[model samples]
Target chain A: MSGAAAFWRKYGVLFKSDWAIMMAYRSETLIWMVGAFVQPLVSLAVWVSLSGEGSIAGYTASDYVLYFTAVLVVDRLTRAWDVYELDRDIREGTFSAKLLRPFHPIHWSINGNIVYKTFFAMLMIPSWLLLAMFFPAMRIPVDMGTIGLVILAIALSSAIRFVIGYQFGLLAFWSNRATAMYALYEGIHMFLSGRIAPLSMFPDWVADAARVLPFYFTVAFPVDLLTGRLADEPETVWIGFAGQAGWLLLLALSLRFIWRNGLKRYGAAGG
Target chain B: MIHVEGLTKIYRVHVRQPGFVASLRSLFHREYREVAAVDGINFDIPEGQIVGFLGPNGAGKTTTMKLLTGLLHPTSGRIEVGGFVPFRQQNAFKKRVSLVMGQKSQLIWDIPASETFLIHKEIYEIPAASFKERIDYFTEMLDLSLIIDKPVRQLSLGERMKCELVAALLHRPDIVFLDEPTIGLDVNMQEALRRFIQSYNRDYKATILLTSHYMADVSALCERVLVINDGKLIYDGAISKLIDRFSPMKRITLVLGAKIDTSVVEAAVRNGGGRVVAYDYPQLEVEGPREEVTGLSAKLLTELPVIDLTIEDPSLESVIGLAYSEGAAGESRR
Candidate 1:
């Protein structure tokens, strides 16, 4: 078979397998999805109370609701749990099974990301529309062209986050603290990725710092795009896409480097 | 089908002492050491041959297997399995080789074992017709018809192992590396898996390299054995030759109808260049060279009323025990 044909065949089967696994854990999946809402809602509640009848950093109470809602959706859609899975698999030695396969291990994780993201989108998008019918704050008034760019940004954001998480997990070859280390990274990401609040709500220095790092591009850029905050700023929109693309390329390269060197250090531990 | 020369894998490991003080000390000044997991080893395996790898824990059998299957990269050495460098781990190379570690599972948890089989079929690019035919044959041979749809997490260890074998062999790989395949299985299950592996080898002519803690597995499935210890290959030959080299003595058992003087039996055994290992009334057990077993039996038959006489070679377990000792000895000398 041609290379692309072979890859498509394998990815299709892997995707089907991952979807079945997700279905088997549908209840837990729902619980996780619901659980992820807590942080964003809490941030929204805080921002709304602080705004009351006024506005803070140009974000009124209704704007806070929409912004956090966008955060919730964008965060869930782009989130990657590969660090946890890869860390456990590598530490427990089940990773050797993945390494021995003809298919790359990263594709399995990527397939899983695709499966879970599609599953979440299927549930989230219609719910957002349904909620928007009664609550004006849940509505997005962007054009279809802007919606296309939002999607491109979300996918690029997801790819960047997935590669970063995967590389963190591959650190298991060198240390047993891979999960803990990724947790630290995730904690920083929680604040700087703008999941807790809009980048504008933070101080100028903090917002600039988030932009300087890869943090803002992963979550805030898509969140901003989805909430229509970038509707009037086409140049900023393109810059966000460019940032996401640049980081995605860099992280993907880092993944190849880490994988090539890591296997040399792999003990294949207990397996 | 497989070749190796100076194949070595060295691991850099953290060294720590046991204590809160040591723990605190290690935080700032950590120590590291190098361990040669698979030190300079050499061997060749022909296709269609089932070879057993005998080694104690930390003996590097699994490391060597991992190197051959491309799951690991050797620190230094040359290895070619089926004409491809295993460490390169090319797609074509991976498709022709399979490694099954008893302690590690590749099956997707929370899903049926058959799901993994389908994924394996695609990853290996097996034709649809052959895929169905292979699964049907394997499931029937393994008696997995009833539980194939059950979640792998819910399956018993033996049942999971049976399904794992099906997943590993679905591609009909040219080389199969089995690391302790029957580690946690019941006697009957182990026997069943051994039979399945033997049949698979016979049908596909796949080169099988297997390691097991159970000597029964080796004795039943492998005619040739490689004994390794401390990361070095100490002995490589037929299992029978190994037994002959390490344990030249054969065990002889005699049951006499009448009680005889213990001194007489002891002296007769000694004169026959053998030692009486045990003596209890009408039953006496002695171990001697293969040549003297018959002569010793003759003297016993004529000197006393012999009711039974049997001669048997030493068990493979004992032979391996001796082999490991020599290997450890060789390590110390180096």
Candidate 2:
């Protein structure tokens, strides 16, 4: 088989294995889901209260609910914890086993993340449905064109975030405290990705700065796609896709560069 | 096959001292020292042979294993395993070899050992039918059926080690590198692992390189041994040769039916050209003068009340200790 074909085959098996492993710890998985969902739910509640009696920054109370709910789903779907896992693996010499494998270790991690998100999103859908039942405003348009764009944006966002996180994880091969650096990266990501609020709600300068970076493209841009924020201008929708593509390419290059350098250092340390 | 020529690995270690002042000083001016972990070792092994890598702690056995498996790169020299440069980490080369460390584990902690086995099957891309056959064979050989389904965290160290061996060999690699594969196991478990490794080598004709502090592991499984000390090869030859060369004396322990004066026995053995090595109540141990052990034994039988007696050659541990002390003394002299 070709390398790509073998990769996909191995990835498929890894995904299934992670799924089974996750299933065995269903309660812990559910607790983690609840913890993640609570963040967006709390944001929605706070935003709704702040928007009482009038729209704030052109977003009504119901729009805030929909936006933050979409934020939860998008965040959950694109989540990548490979940095933490890699840090643990590197420190404990478990990475030696991974290095022995025939395929790149990142492929296994990506498969693990994808499988985990798929199962997590399944559990999340019912909560979304129940919330939609009580709040009609949370419903999005069923237009096929916008829905297709949302799917594309989501796929790119997942790939970009995964590669970016993987690149950070590879740093563990060189440094002892990779998780600390990862935490700092995530702290920057929170504000730049508009996790707390829409970019428009931020100061004009802040929002403009975030636009040029890739963080907003990872989370907010896809959320905007689902909320019909790109409906008025089809060209801007393509621009969002372009941003996703550019960031994906950049992060892929960064991941490759860091992995090579880190492997060199790892060889030295182990030798 | 494996070839290592002038294989060397150097480590740059940062030196630090305790105290706030020292820590502050270190931040501005760090001290670095170059430690040679493996210094220019050369060896070659043909296919399907089991070679014991014997070394004391920090003698670079594990480092060499890591380098051979592509987990590490040598500071200098070249190494080839299974006809490929190990440090290059070629996919085909990796697929043909496996490394197992007894102190570390690869099995997922929260899951059954079967989960790890399945994952390995997928990672190695074994055919489903072949994977099942291998799993069946390993399970039977390792006696893993009873514990394979239980969570790995719940298994005893010995059981986990058996499972670990099963996991390592399921891919059916042509070369296997094992580092202390029986470090913490009891005697029975250690023997079982030794037997499993021997059978695996015999059945598959796989080349094996094993490093263990346990001399029994080498004595039981390996015919040839490589003894290293202070990052240098001190001895490399047959296991029996190592024992015979380092240890020139044999031990004989005798039990007396009656309480005999220990001094009289010691005097007799000393007079007979044998050295009295140790003496306990009702028992006498003697070493040296192998040529006269028979005469000494006969004389003791006729002159003293003898109950039972046994003779033993020097053990591998004693041989290794002798080698290390000799190496230390040689270094001090230089």
Candidate 3:
């Protein structure tokens, strides 16, 4: 086997190990799932009440339900916990052991995250089907072309989010409280990624700004693809993909830069 | 093989006083003190040799181990393990060496130690046949069959340590760096581990560098010991020579058959040019020069009803203590 093939083989083993670990904490996983679904559910309910007896901001109550539910599922599928893992490892000197290994630490962390998200998506599918059954507007246009693009967008978005979170996590090598910085980043992402409402609901300048930033590409762009918000506009779809690709490339470069600097700082900290 | 020259590690430790005001003041202007964790030191060990690194707490033993293992980069030094610079952490270099810290663990806490063993097999990319054979060998040697399947959190300290050793050695690396591997083990467990280490070294022809405060570990496993104090090498030679040079006085213990006057024995031993260190009902411990001890033992055998008697040198513990104190006093004068 080639080098990349061997790496994937090792990654497959790690994925299995992560699956077992996640299963061991099934109750905690369920609690996290509930927590995740509740946010979007609440947003959908509020929008439904706000659009009572008529459509508000060009979105019917059913549309609101579908959009928010899609957002919830997409968010759950793409969430990355690398920041927390990186912070803990750097702080406790656990990263020293990882550095001893042959492969880079990020590859293992990403594999573990992907495994966790895949399992989580399996659990979320039933809820997704149930929500779509009751709300006709929640139904996605299941064409092969759109489906392929959505899948590609999901892949790119996950990479972007993972690298972004990893870069923040690497700050622990230099900073005392890196988790606090991550919390700040999460706060900004909440509003910018349309977690509470669609980016269309924001003012023109704010929506334009969100479109230009990477946070929106993580959730809003994929949700747009699923909810038909970007339908009939191939240019917008291409732009979404381009933005994700650009951010992925930038974050990857930044992740490499921060990782090198962080390792140097870690060595200074006695590793 | 391992080589190190002029290895140095300096840490910028933040200094703060204990008060809210001090903490507030430190926000704007912080004080930093440079601590020399490892000063300039040079050593070389050939492959397959088990060398003991002896030192007191905070004497740069762990620091040196970390440096050699590439966990820490030296400020100004050159180190090579198996022809690869450790700090570079090349894949082939990492594959050939392993580091085991007794106080810290690499095993997954909520899972069985076997899981960690499997993970390490993957990480090291060991073949299935070789991995299985190595696991079987370690399991048998370390007596890990019973505890290997249990969750790491459920195992006793000694059991956990044994499992850790197996996990570390399963890869069968050519070089092993063990830092305080017998810190909290009971006597029997320590003996078992020491025996396993010796056998592993001999069987694999692996170079082993071990650091520990337990002198028994050094005495049993290492013929050549490197003693470090205050980030400096004080002595590097055979363990027996160290004991002999540091502890010139020999200790002779006698088991008396009958109750004897302590003062009489003490006076006689003093006159015979030996010092009576301790006296109990049936036993007496005397310390003196070798020749005087021999003569005094003969005199005591003639005088007292000696049921049993034995003469021995001071233990490694006392010898190292004396070495540290002497070294400390000498440094103070400088």
DockQ (CA atoms), all models: 0.65, 0.50, 0.45
Give the chain B TM-score achieved by candidate 2.
0.86
Q: What is the lDDT for A128 in model 3? A: 68
Q: After TM-score superposition, what is the CA distance of residue A251 in candidate 3 from its true location, in Å?
A: 1.0
What TM-score should be assigned to candidate 1?
0.89
User: Model 1 - which docking category?
Assistant: medium
Question: Over the true interface residues, superposed, what is the Cα RMSD of model 3?
Answer: 2.2
Write the residue-wise lDDT of candidate 3 on B152-245 in tens digits: 9999989998988887787788899998899889999999999999999999999999987777898889998888877877777788877766
Q: Report the C-alpha displacement of residue B96, candidate 2, in angstroms.
A: 1.0
Which candidate's DockQ is highest? 1
Ranking of models by DockQ: 1, 2, 3
Task: Report the poorest 10 consecutive residues by lDDT, candidate 2 chain A.
Answer: A262-271
Candidate 3 lDDT score at position B98: 86
Question: Which runs of model 3 end up more than 4 angstroms from their true locations?
Answer: A267-271, B248-318, B328-334
- Across B159-273, the per-residue lDDT of candidate 1 in tens digits comes to 9999999999999897999999999899999999999999999999999999998868998999988888779887787877677667888998888898888888888888878
lDDT of 1 by residue, A160-195 (tens): 889999999999988889989999999999999998
* Candidate 2: tens digits of C-alpha lDDT, residues B73-152: 78999999989998788889988999999888878888889888878877788889999998888888888889999999
Report clash pairs, candidate 1: none
Better of 1 and 2 by DockQ: 1
Ten contiguous residues with the weakest lDDT in model 3 chain B: B325-334
Query: Model 2: what is its DockQ?
Result: 0.50
